[model samples]
Target: MLKDKMKEVMQYNSILNQPNAQGRYKNYKCFHCKQMGHIAKFYPMDYKKEVSDMKKDTKVQGFKASKSTELITYPKIIHFSTTCMIKDTDLTNWDKIWYISDQINRHVCYKLDNFYNIKEGFSVTKLKNQKKFLFTYELGEVLIEESGKSIMILGMYYAPEVTLNILSLDLLEKQGFETKYDGNRCTLSLIFKDKEVHTFDEDRMKKMHNKYLQDYFESLSK
Candidate 1:
């Protein structure tokens, strides 16, 4: 039933592609911002390191900080990303990008590199904080408590047939999401007025979800 409804919605979205389409889409509001033509939490990017970053040794430009030796559990790479999508809005602007990028570098990836031996050259590249970076970890006994909150950061099992990256889970959880997993399958959905911080994921989402769980947990431990 839901798939059929989705099909109808897609058809309506296609109409916007017409030569002279305009105005708010009927029954086609974005789930993310509750606007038109998008969803509330749409994240489609490679959460792992990009190949271009590792392709060559470009001069160390951008933000620089002292390298440190620390014991940190880094976000496990399950897959890489190529592209992402966002609704057309003024809210999605350069300022947010720069801010997010800075956070990712200073708080998430760079710190993790200090503790764990992440991919080569990851330590040197300037990390950018995208919404996606915060959530990506392997599921283990590790739990990171941040903002005075206790939560587990988990990761995906590396398999022979699949690649993974981070996406919407972090944002969803921030909005109070409830997720569950059986070590292999992760099912995620919004929890309305709920208090439990336990998040869930399955299939491909599980790998990324676990990574997030790991990252969050490690951050708290530090």
Candidate 2:
């Protein structure tokens, strides 16, 4: 009688194992959490926690992510453009220019000829050890606009004509903005005083600057 009862129980379990309308068994196991009765997609996951953890890790590692193609969004971005000069001679003649952002720089720099009307009371100093093998002669303030917001940036006029105006990473951080870097891309975001701003894709901007530098160097070699 015990053997017969055991066989009946097995038969009932076999009947319960029949496929459902979705072609999955009634006792389907979730592929994600490995729990019974659901699939991977239906599994409940704490996506917010996962994302928060990821961002925390990113912050702990100096705000640099490993992925090259990752898209990082910021709350605010300041956009500006500057003209490039060859041989540092005609600074006023604006022909070709490119947009650029420097993640490692501390100050904005402009060619002397770019600013036509200059006030007499500005200080001029010889700045050395600049990146892209450039040097600066004069330092002054320039009023720049981004998203209708006007901010003054202390700009240095470099001896060599530069085709790009740089947004300084160090200065941005000092202004309460957070900087994040992923591969060639850099992002500056500010979240303070209940305000947010994000910049554009820095990877593309940096690449354009690098291309200009390469061409400049190549022309010099020629």
lDDT of 2: 0.45
Write candidate 2's Cα lDDT for 1-222 as tens digits: 997687556534543453451456436775544546545454334433554677767633112223446443522222333222112222334432212344335454454433422333333333343322444445555434333343444443433334355655556567676655545444344547464576689999999999999999999998
Output the number of the TM-score-best candidate.
2
- Compared with the true structure, all predictions reach lDDT values of 0.35, 0.45
Residue lDDT tens for model 1, 34-72: 445533233112211232455434523223335756544
Model 1 Cα shift for residue 60 (angstroms) = 43
Model 1 TM-score is 0.18
Alpha-carbon deviation at 73 in model 2, angstroms: 44
Residue-pair clashes per candidate, as listed?
A: 45, 8
Worst 10 residues of 1 by lDDT: 96-105
Stretches of candidate 2 exceeding 4 Å from the true structure? 1-103, 113-133, 155-160, 177-222
